[model samples]
Target: MLSRNRAAAARSMPGEGQRSSGRAAQRLLVALLGAAVGAAVAQADEPILPIPPAPALDARKLALGQALFHDKRLSNDNTLSCASCHDLSRGGVDGRSSSIGIGGAKGPINAPTVFNSSLNFRQFWDGRAASLEEQAAGPVHNPLEMGSNWAEVLGKLSRDAPLVEQFKAAYPDGLQSRNIQDAIATFERSLTTPNARIDRYLRGDKSALSPDELRGYQLFKAFGCVACHQGVNVGGNMFQTFGVMGDYFTRRGSVTAADLGRYNVTRNDADRYAFKVPSLRNVAVTAPYFHDGSARTLNEAVDVMFKYQLGRSAAAQDKELIVKFLHTLTGEYQGRSLQQADPLVARRP
Candidate 1:
């Protein structure tokens, strides 16, 4: 039954998901997958944005959260907010090699984009938090990150009459740090970017993308880049090592404390060097890439991924085309109004 399903899916799915239209694509995909892709091709039909959109944002709540996301007051020394690392205008990343935490502490890891982050299986590099609410509270409490103890942060929030009143209204249980985190997390959940050229193409608009973008998409699949980087988020649902068929960490040298990666969370040797794959949406805008932000240019990041993750190299032409296609992945936040209009956002001081 599975074989028949796969065979049928393969014959029908072409170019995004069609038959007559994607003969070339189907042929290429079949060649790349070597039969396995045929069976699971149907699975690819699923949209990547499974994350339920945040409930209609309460303006005061999201405004409050947005303020907090950019609020330096949440830091011990009033130096950093979520925006310090995850700047939305810059593709939701700050474009730094490593994020500067409280008191100018340089973190060992790159600041992952906050845009569309809610789609991940788990939050953070280590997959520690299970939900956005928990994840939002993480940085503030991280000694090196925000450096603000939740209790102290709560105390400060309590002092802000406007913030307190909004919080009170949002949560009948009354304002607390956890509630604040949930509100902010909800706001973050609304921070989704959609409608890239690829999206238009996926939705059956062939003219939405240029021919170069289409070729890049072909190269992306032909070279098997989508094996792990598939789905609506375009790569957040799975975890893989930096080097599957290569030695990425070894190439970099001795594993630093921060480079322990998933081992720190999983405490398993097999998990060493493993990290959750990041989303490619807005990747062109989010430069200074990777877990540690070692790659400064998107081209360099693509080169590194070719060498390490996919275990293959791209021809110069193919590389250029893929990079060009990658630019199309950048899109506008689909839920910005929710965040900006949330009562919580409006209510924040």
Candidate 2:
């Protein structure tokens, strides 16, 4: 009876057209399965995560903060603004190896990018400033930076009727130092860049990343580079010694007080040469790299990382591929590509 029923069902089945359609569907299913497995493998090896878009902020406060950010009144000399070191038009950095402050005084360490700094667990290379608000206050009062006290700054701001009015609209206390810090910090938080090709790939767009970029990402993880550089900000959530496998400072020669890194803040020997891991977002544009800015190009930076941090050597091709992946991390700022805003240094051979 089973055989008879099977024969009847076969007889009722569609002709060659339906059979061909079924075969095609099966092939498609197999192809999809293969792609899914590939993607899963890629994900398992991916360590760095994509940055999310900036959250909605109060427009009034953001506007006020932007004005204050560009206003030179914050500096004692009236020649330097917050924008002097952190140039919004140049990848949120001044493009100097070490930033120049008031009266042409150079800072001890390299200035990290201001973009997406709020994502960092702690501010500054030494992690001295706990939050963006605290970080904002550092340069303003530092003898080398803006070189002005709150009294001087507020006195200048108070003279400007428009700025004072804007401050009143943004803060209940108006032009106080705390309110200024709050406003600048809020503006910094809004500086996040999202929607990079790598981010799109992370969001499940299979075609977003090229074959080289995907390979580079896998290699980046396999090489243990991800251990220190994981999470949304890539490398900002924790602190790591600059020279894990080698004496980087000694080799570089010229170890300054800034090179003491987190040791300066903690005063612990264990924290020697330890610095807060900087975010890799928009890194391609924000060079020269590292706390000292020793590496002038991305290729050179990758080499330095492998030698000092990873203690592992990679082939030149592999290094190039890794650099390619890094390039994909440059995202859009205000609906435009960020790389276009800054002129990158020429690549070294």
Candidate 3:
């Protein structure tokens, strides 16, 4: 009887061991499936893309546009040019909270950088202009901007024999307002800055980013910034409310017409405070950020995004890392680093 019992016990032990092994295998399979699902979620959530260089353009047209862009004669008082608001040497922005326009007039909104603007689906913070051509026509006639009618601008341009000759060379129809807009728009399209370190990293150059930058990028993705700020230009392709999680205007106080954002164009309450997401390319130098330019520094801008747009609190280290990642977005303009040519003028209190 004892021998029989030992034999049964030995057989049961092998069976029990087999069941245990099967359970271990099942757990392993479940873990692998979970890992795969997690990877898919991450990929779906964060899709980073590199910004390609601008396409080649006609040299004569590009030159003509650059001249027009810098020519102050476009303004009513001959005191400002496109360059006055968008300083090409300074990340394509004047580094002011609000642009100073004709007759020392202050613009209602911040001047977004012209660099890579061609990639945007629409122009302006409110997405009022459907194309760069339409956008070019805006400031020229805006009362606070260039403050000049198209007729006055054409009259001024027609007087310059060299400019007229160049215009004729560039456009078959010559220097009409439409042609001028076309030329300026074409030049603005050429103002793209490529070869950013972050772009290189996206293009599979692992060494392009440092350890901190890589971690910062991961954090940027993890924190859900990429939800709005994604794609080639990184945020220009869409519009989002300024404060998704909180009332930015109420917090800041003294809301202006500019704060209305896309509401001015749509006249819909739902569109209130909706603004075209500005591209993050060269954002480090385009300080005094947002439609109002309330955030003074990159760090402050990140903090505001977390508090208002993201509706979350982030550790100081995370914010610093995110800022470091943003710095990597600065790129080269015609083989040279795109940086502010001068220190930003102090904003008025």
Candidate 4:
């Protein structure tokens, strides 16, 4: 009886080890599968993408462009430069409801940020300028803005021997209006602000955003803000009617010719009030929001968007969260965060 019992015990012990090994393999498989699912979920959820680093451009052209951007001689009276409206140190905006140009003239539409302008499919608020080069020529020619024609600008700039020399060095064609535009456009292209907290998160740094900020981003997508404001520049890739869900201009009233938006360019009735959706990158600092520049604060801007653009209402808490998430989109320029470089000029949300 003792010998029979010993044999049975040995057989049972062998089966027990095999059973334990099988259970361990199953657990490992489940863990791997769970990890894969989590990754898939994360990928599926994120619609926005990270801003890529500025492309490698010619150093000579970039330097020439940077000089021309800040040179007030581009303006008629030498009072305003490109930097006057699109100040790089100040989130590439003048922080006004509408940019003030030469002789205290106020622009009709808000001056969109020069930062990341290269990423945009079209240049101005109405999507009138198709390229950065075309856009650069605009302000100089505009009567209310720089108030200078290409010929006048060339005459003024030619007086500066050093600038002419630099232009010649940068372009074989020398100091022409087209070359000037190219140089300024080249510098504008370099103004892209990458390395935002949201960008890091998009690049798989899970720890990049705080809990509330992450929640805000989720709400932003859930609430359909991402429909117009996605892609590398966050919102510059497309055009959408400002008041899709509601008549925004009617509510605001006093709609001007500028408010006609893309209609001015296309002359199509359907394109009325349609504007190139402005990029939300660094929006926290570039305040007095919208093409109309009506929303004075980021919070107000979000509210207006919810009401007019989405035609929906969100809780106060959700709106607050969305604004917080927007704060994460403020990115680094020249190795410094835009917030640090220039604190938000607008009142806090």
TM-scores of the models, in the order given = 0.80, 0.86, 0.85, 0.86
**Roughly what TM-score does model 4 have, to 2 decimal places?**
0.86
Worst 10 residues of 2 by lDDT: 340-349
Per residue, candidate 2 scores C-alpha lDDT tens digits across 52-98 of: 66888888889988888898888999989989888877788877788
Tens-digit lDDT track of model 4 for 135-228: 9899998989999998888898888899889888888889999998898888888998899999888767889999999999999999999999
Ranking by lDDT: 4, 3, 2, 1
In the order shown, what is each candidate's alpha-carbon RMSD? 13.2, 6.8, 12.8, 8.4
For model 1, the superposed segments whose C-alpha errors exceed 4 Å read 1-55, 334-349
Q: What is the per-residue lDDT of model 3 for residues 1-349, given as tens digits with 9 covering 90 to 100? A: 9999999998777587798999999999999999778755654455656767679888998898888899999999999999988888778888788988877888898899999999999999999999999999999999999999999999988989998999889888888999889889989988888899987776556799999999999999999999999988888999999999999989999999989999999999999999999999888878878989887788888999999999999999998998888888888898988864222333332
Candidate 4 residue pairs in backbone clash: none
Between prediction 1 and prediction 2, the one with superior TM-score is 2
User: Model 4: how large is the Cα RMSD against the reference?
Assistant: 8.4
Off by over 4 Å in 3: 1-46, 340-349
Q: Candidate 2: lDDT of 178?
A: 92
Q: What global local distance difference test value does model 2 have?
A: 0.86
Candidate 2 — which residues are off by over 4 angstroms? 1-46, 340-349
Lowest lDDT 10-mer window, candidate 3? Answer: 340-349
| CA lDDT, candidate 4, residue 332 | 88
Worst 10 residues of 4 by lDDT: 340-349
**Local accuracy of candidate 1 as per-residue lDDT tens digits, 1-349:** 9999999998775555455557777887879776456434533563433233345777767776777787777888888888888877666777677777987787878888898897778888877788898888888988888888877887777878987887777788777877778778877877887666677666556797799998998888888888888787889888888888898888988678778778898799998888888888777777667787777666787889899888876688998898888777766665332122111111111
